[model samples]
Target chain A: MTKRAALTDLPLVLDRVSLSAGATTMLDRLNLAITPGAPTLVLGPNGAGKTSLLRVCMGLAAPSAGTVSWGGRTDRGLGRRAMLLQKPVMLRRSVAANVAYALAQAGCPRHRRAARTEELLDRVALLGLAARPARRLSSGEQQRVALARALAREPEILLLDEPTASLDPAATRHVEEIILMASQSGTKIVMASHDLGQVRRLAGDVVFLVRGRLCEHASVGDFFDRPSSAEAAAFIHGELVL
Target chain B: MSEGLDAWQLIASGDATLISIVRLSLTVTLGAVAVAAVVGLPLGALLALTRFPGRSALVVLVNGFMGLPPVVVGLTVYLLLSRSGPLGEFGLLFTPAAMVIAQALLVLPIIAALTRQTIEDLWREYRDELTAMGVGPTGRVATLLWDSRFSLITAMLAGFGRAAAEVGTVMIVGGNIDGFTRTMTTTIALETSKGDLPLAMGLGAILIGLILAINAAAWGLRLWSEQRVA
Candidate 1:
């Protein structure tokens, strides 16, 4: 597969986005900008609209009255965008077939599609299980397959909603390594995570959401050292501040 | 004992009339099921996905039709398609097409209703996943229906069993014309009323066999879908 050139130039900007379902609010006037090649971590407790903000940024959920602009253009299609959910959805096909399907949809050529899937399988270390039923894989294995499928698109922006949510320590490290490698390749990575260790390891910056509102948007070093909000301080102290 | 054994010989010897009746029964049942599936699957998906003002009323109507009285359906269709009734212009009465249409009406609701239930249940899981993947409207609906293909197949089989084994609608609408629309169910009905006990019994055995086959298929689909869910 001919890998598409990396998007090392464009910025993803979500300005004053608010998402509400019925009367209850998900995201409340969240404003932030995401620079390419920087892994941004979204940290928040439950019910904070962390996932909702990612959905808005990925163009999955529309903001009630705000703009999600990619490259300063609100109307630009998110064609080169890819998002992974907490519990990834896999096709009922083989592991390799799942990757191939995503690559094909991303406009990879016929000959390139298979080779891309093979390379992804190797990268995810699931080459031996290429033909095994994807649905039957363990949770960690399924998560990797989902990652491989997403990266096969060679997306300009990668949005992950708790990609390592339920994985064990080793599994978490493996996923973190993949994200790091993709970030190095100049594919912008945006992740929502609860694990502070993971946030520290991968995110160049942190965007914190608290109760559907933006509490902090700062560099990783500054965020962990001197969080501006009491909620972030309480959260860093490992106290539940919801 | 002698009469029953002799009827078995008739069934085994490839009796042209019996063979044709059985084949016709299969055709009408499968044709109705195919048509019902095409219409009912989309209706089911819509019912499960959309939230309109009349949603509950529509659900109630569909659930009511799932258990609709077969004889009432037969009577209404019989009147409409009969020689003196509303849709008699094209002269579709007492024909295989009439049977197909009546049976499709009966079966379509069952498939549609059950498919709606299946999709509604799966929606809770798929809604977030599809949204996060940025699946658009058309793609979202199509993948939901396709992913639950096994459940829909079970729904169609359930419809098939009801349509194929039914007697009232086909007899009334098709008139059970010999060599034209005479099917297994109607043959059994005719043979019984006319006091040909042995032939009716033979047809009854065959009809039961067909029912068992269709139900087994439905059960298989259920099991396969269950395995996936598990």
Candidate 2:
């Protein structure tokens, strides 16, 4: 069977997007564009709207105001993008089945599903535990399974929210490696993280946010070296941005 | 005393009449459950996943129907199938088919209401991930139903229990025709009315035992499957 057509040409643009829940704003007229390229890391303090931004970009949440478009089209580019929430909810099934579910959702042919599932499991080093229930796995292992599931979609754009937030150092390294491998394989990676070290190690560009508003968007090197905004500078220096 | 011993003896001997009644009971109730499940599960899943005008009212209506009186359902079906009634041409009244119809009507809301509750709870937990995966409406229903299978099995069992334990519906619709339409509950009611307490007690014991066994088997299956998949 042939692969689904890629959506790599579409650049995700958020034009003056604002999201509010009741009284509090989660995203404040945030204007940004995520073009096809290296991994872009979103850095922010607690409640900085990193998650909300990713949700809007993934088309999982509608912004209360303004518009989000992909390749100048306002449609959600379904099957072309996938997101791994901060805490992934595993299907009540085996590890292999979880990836297979994603594969099936991505419209993988019936005959190709098993092979594709196995390939995704192997990529995450979860082939040995293929028959194990996904929910019973360790948090780090579940995170990897979630990665494999996201990868199973062959998504052109993969969004992750703190994919390694609760993982140990070794597990974090493993996740980062898989992520970099996905990035190398032409998937545009947009990830949110709090770890500055991870940002330095994995990010090509940094989008910094403070209180639901964009503070800076620059190349990782420039953002880390020059530190444009006081909030970004203060954030990098390990000081409280608020 | 002697009566209790006779009831046990009747059960141990696998009395032909008793066995046939048990068989008919299983056939009608299981048939009713099958019919109800076919219609109710998808309807329940749809209610859980969709919203529209009067959806809440429909949900409330289905929930309220869960406690519908079996005698009332039996009377309604009787009227529907009685001679000179709209469906009289097919002649379903006072037959096992009539009993199945009445019991199905009695069980449908229980299964559907419980299934709606189960799928709704599961849907909440699965919403974001499924949406991100681009699963469509039908896919969402199928997923929620499959994942909530254990809970749904319990819902089905609840329906079965309701159908099996009630005598009024089957008694009215089946006419308690011995050697034909008689079921365990109907037979028990008939024997008791005729003062044949031993036979009634024996059938009562078997009915309770059968329900207990089914529930046990379902419980075990759910436990084993959950362990395998959890």
Candidate 3:
């Protein structure tokens, strides 16, 4: 299916956001705007706060100094959003039940839940294993189930943190395809990734972080070809950004 | 012992007094379990999910209560139910109702503490997913309790075992009135004291059987659920 226009809201805005613990800063005065379109990728080295950034946007963590507004809606009103964490947790049930639980929590009507669950599992290529226990699945399969769960929410903004970090190349390809499809269908995709090759394939725009600071935000082509910041340049060249 | 063999013969003969004792034992313990579950399940879920000042201290207190001496509980209940005590107006001392109350009090802490541990471990795994799904605090607790249903069943069984086996609480509160409030544990105590070794041994065997039956049932449920999940 082709990506549809966003149904909930447009342009998640973060203004002067900062998350700090004691003296350690995780996200420092970062500002950005995300509108529905192509996928946006967040890239940074370990401890650079890539995961923390996604968490803040998901409203799992409060920004110590700034505001994150989803079309003027606060976290309580952001119910139409769903996130897949770096280490996704599977509900202790059948694969289909995991997706269905998400659907139920999202307020999907009871009568329609089964069909929705089947469709989501099919989209993630997990239909055959619908009756299998979710936690008993392989790590790659579990990730797919987590993705299926996120899609079951019919979310406008889908946040993913290293969704394919544990997958093999074949599994990674399958996941990347579904992500691209979701982006094409107009579900705004915001993701954190360490694999540069993946960024090349999925990112429409790139947000680069260096030690809790927003070093650069650029379109994939511009960011790759022109390379505005030294960190982005070094990062693209496969050099670690401290 | 030859007395153990004779006790089996009494069980086989299905003596009326033995039947009444067994029935009473089941009633009192099951009643205690039901009452404890009503209060303990919510308390445990609350303790597992919420955080406030003194929570740690409260958790320690509940854990400590699990090891409460049955004789102390008996004396405390006895005093409260005596005509000179605060709750004397109820006139519940030396009755089955009093026995149920004492057993419920003893079982509550076991159910609550085990439930807290089980649900807390599950909450750790489920917190992010449930939160991202927009589930509220109540929803989180309900979901964790359901997902951890197998472990919670074991907790209930543990409460039942404690309730059924403890003699001090029921003996003091029920007064071990023959044919009126006599339970298997209390009957065993009376018969043993009267030197009727065979009957006491029979009641003891029946009590052990009931406990084993409960554990076996819980084990079966765990297996069935595990298979269904897999």
Candidate 4:
């Protein structure tokens, strides 16, 4: 029912981070810092390791080299963190129950669950469908429920991997509005997206990745106006960059 | 057709011996399923969620055991419950309790292996979501098992069917004690051996019908729950 207390981890820093599976490199010697305030957007083409980068930030994947630290600590518990995958998984239960499950996992009390679930479903504009089976819902609806579930944790850092990649225009707008509102409320959104339009709308900072390498990290205006790397320039012009 | 009609008559008339046998069959099979579920569900869930060096080997072992010979299970249990054997202190041999134990042993692998498969499939879908919710390993297993319960119920029913249809284990362990541990399967075996063709046919028909009923009830429950969930 209650939001998480103020952020304890800030200025999330990645140092020489590399990830490899077998002989294939996924992320290569990436060094970056994400300071508090403003939503950071990660952009890259297919197979550029956007998802892997988000997973590393969420502590879901281990890096083969270097380290990622949240506020100078790598051992902090992940209870205050939440990540949304590209295709969100819906629990085999009612929409409200999915949110309640998250709330219960976060140790919210039984008495508070009903109100909290109501608030979350309403927040996602899914209150009318609260009793519907989550998996039976449309993809866009399921994505909204996933967002509500993530918010149920009251996370300090929300990592999203193309959370709206499959949604229609209207659905995408709804999700973007919610993400923007969460950003304004200081949840500290770190999202990876393929939608340049979405990037233009929500990105305060942009981290451009190419073939698992960090090509550019700059404020959205600067990155768009005076592109630092050839890859960034090519990507901006809608040209494919390998 | 004549034997089936006679069976219908026996069932309609509620013959005492046939009723007792049917009741015992249900008791032993249901008991076996209960015991197997208690042990197997958690074991299956553990196998699904954790990774260890021999985990694949263990999974293979459990899967292999699903086809375990009921007669062999009977002999093993019979040996264990024999007077001079290790578990003989409880003196469970040649009783309905022994039959239940043997059937439970026979059914355990069925329940556990099916549970492992069902929960593993559900886990693949749920892993990211649950992990993001900060569910630790144990909680994730618990959640998955609970969510996949309808399928697990189907698994239990499969075990129940195997237990009820099995005569080998109950025959060896129960000794087919008339008016006591003579369940439908054992009684059918006994009647057929004694050349009582009509009684054997009747009991066989009843056994098949009872199993069909159980399956129908279980399927109905699954459908109802699914509808509610949907």
Candidate 5:
């Protein structure tokens, strides 16, 4: 099998990226650079374009104006990146099979997929439910399975959209543990979240957005302790930012 | 009442002629279904996933063809395969092959149209995920088709139901030759014309029973497998 290009597409950069759908602007001249590091948690209000920004970074959505380049290449070679949506869609198959499908798509040889699937499932603490249909699993379990699937791709950059928003405390903790594990293993993590506690626990830095514009980007300590933007200050205090 | 009794007796006794007719019916209908599925499934998947000029018009044409009269299809196939027609040299007219062709033509539209709808809905649910996975066009089609297999089974059965239940196409193409091209539906039609109610009723019962049994088996299999994997 031909080898895929190594994950050298680091420091994903966006240059004045703007996205719009007719009269509605989803992303407004957002400039950001995500370098290799600890997990970066994107915090924003609803309609603040957090999801839209991740979609752009993942190369799933093209910006209407401006450009996004991975490393230095403008072409979207998605082999080195994987993403988890707010509500991950489980394939209509077994949990093990769902991971197996991702491995197969990632070009893992047929002979090695089974062992790899087991390993990934075990990492997510879902080895016991390997044979169960993935779609029938609880939402928390599904999120973990989605995490396992994203891990299956062996991505250099992992982008997640609200990976644990709907989970109970226990389940949310489980997911966070897996995410932390993934980050420690050298994969760059960029995730969006609504939970403030989650943001404190998982974020190395915070990218705060308001109405499709980037309002603040700072280290976790600085952002929460001394937020420069009025919007970020109000948002950190749980005041409505409208 | 006597005719019903005779019909039940014929069915119970497994008369040679009745058995032959039933076997031919299954052979012809299943053969047609196989042919239709081979051509229709991919066509349907393509229609669902791709966009091009005149695609809507083509979709409407396929949908319209689903309601085409079997006799009309038979007539068209007859003209194509008749002795004086373009395919005259092969001499397939009045044979089971001709009947299979006619029935395949009649059933293809139903299978294709239904498959298009099934794959389209599945594509909607799977679009973002599959695209995110970087699955290409052919992979997208294969993935959607395999994932939609349960729904597609119903589409195939609908095609089988149409082919098995229709006499007009087979009668025109097969000539209903006894011990040869005669199928359950064609036999019932011929026997009814000759006032042989018992024989017609026997074949009719077997036809209905066969359709019901196949449908039930498919439903059970789908339910069982879906529970296991869905």
Candidate 6:
């Protein structure tokens, strides 16, 4: 999983970032930098700000305390980066069209969007359902479509918040393969997953957040085997760390 | 009995009043629904998607207006357009334009409130997905509208039904001016009051037909959405 791509400065940098919603801070003074081609997974218990951290990085939810600089710019121009959610959002269109819309909105040339959509659909095992209405698909198929949509952007960074939170075993395996394929193609993936086993299988690096604070950042092997913090240790043992 | 059958001959021969009334009903209802759509849809979208202190109050107000009495709305507009009222200079009362205005007012709240309900209900399910998908604010709002398009279509058709069959509002505002503001409902009322039972019954029959057409379309949309969901 540590097959790094071409070298660059940080693609996503969050400096002392904090998120507060109506007097409740979700992420507080958390500084982190994710580089090009790095697959970082955020893992913690319920209400541990894992999803909030992903949002701050994506500019969907603004951080209050500090800055988030993306590719040397602190702006919404980084919208080209894509994201996936646990509950897949499908439009009233064909699955291919959903992927195409993501690429097209990111300014991918019209001629290329179709080809890219088809390729991603194949990669996600949704090629057969390309013509199917996205809204008509089962939850698993919809998630695959969502994954295809995210990768079609050919994003410099991909953010996922519990993309497989509620799937059966077979569906989870299918989505995991799709994501693993996307990461192979050099998409920098930052994800949040409650499934620690999936995190172990997929993550190159792990970020541990607790009560709006980042407690640990380590290589996946190190974090799972010899967690540095008491919080991380408690979490590693099947206890609610939050 | 022989004269009673002549009403069928009038329908067969394409009677001018009958055709004109049908055409007028179509245009006035369509025109009013268009205006209400333009005004109420965006308001509904905003009310549903936005968060502010008065949002609940606004929702209550829009929902409350869904039950507003049509005649009361028509009477209010008639007063406003009367020569002595505030906007009397326009001389709009007793014209088809006034009828259109009154009808649009009557349906705007219904469209707005129902559209808001549809979008809000949809937002509850998909807002998190939309946010995580990085759909911009505009796209999120537009997506909710598009996703609930079937529901919106039915809401609009319901609004059209309300506009088409409405009697008191169009009667008061239009003055049932023959060959002009006269519509199916108003004509039916006029014919009924004048003891012209045959014409009144014919118009009533047409009104029922129009209602059937609208309900059929709305039901079709609902069926299509369900089939897709399946």
- Cα lDDT of model 4 by residue, B87-163, tens digit: 99999999889998999999999999999999989988888778778898878878998899998998999899899
Q: Write the per-residue lDDT of candidate 3 for residues A76-144, one digit (tens) a residue.
A: 444467899988988889999999998888778899999999999999999999999898999999999
lDDT of each: 0.83, 0.91, 0.88, 0.89, 0.90, 0.82
Question: DockQ for each candidate?
Answer: 0.27, 0.85, 0.66, 0.73, 0.70, 0.30
lDDT of 1 at A239: 96
Which residue pairs collide, candidate 2? none
What's the residue-level lDDT of A125 in candidate 1?
88
DockQ winner, 1 or 5 = 5
Q: Which runs of model 3 end up more than 4 angstroms from their true locations?
A: A1-7, A75-77, B1-5, B79-94
TM-score of 6: 0.84
List, residue by residue over B1-230, the lDDT tens digit for candidate 1: 12444457767887777788889999999999999999998898899999999999998999889998888888888888887998989799898999998999999899999989988987777776555444566776677787787778778888998998899999989988989998888888887887888878877888888788878877886677556442
TM-scores of the candidates in the order shown: 0.88, 0.97, 0.93, 0.96, 0.97, 0.84
CA deviation > 4 Å runs, candidate 4: A1-7, B1-6
The fnat scores of all predictions, in order, read 0.20, 0.80, 0.61, 0.68, 0.56, 0.32
Please tell me which model should have the higher lDDT, number 2 or number 5.
Answer: 2
**For candidate 4, lDDT tens digit of each residue in A1-242?**
23345436567889999999999999999999988788999999999989999988888888899999987788636747788889998888999999999999988899999999999999999999999888899999999999999998887789999988999999999999999999899888999998888999999999999999999999999989999999999999999898
A1-242: candidate 6 lDDT, tens digit per residue: 02212422256888899899888889989989898655899988889998889877777777787999886778754445778875667877788878887776555688887788888888888889888888888898888888877776566688898988888999999888877777887778899998889888999999999999999999999998999999999888888664
Model number with the top DockQ: 2
Standalone chain B TM-score for every prediction: 0.90, 0.95, 0.93, 0.95, 0.95, 0.89
What is the CAPRI rating of model 6's predicted complex? acceptable
Error of 3 at A109 (Å): 1.7
Which scores better on TM-score, 1 or 3?
3
Residue pairs in candidate 4 whose N, alpha carbon or C atoms collide under 3 angstroms: none
- lDDT (0-100) at residue A23 of candidate 4? 96
Which residue runs does candidate 5 get wrong by more than 4 Å? A1-7, B1-5
The true-versus-predicted C-alpha distance at residue B225 of model 1, in Å, is 9.2
TM-score of 2: 0.97
For residues A100-217, could you state the per-residue lDDT of candidate 1 as single tens digits? 8677666678888878899999988899999887888999999999999888768788989998888899998898888899889988889999889888888899998899999999
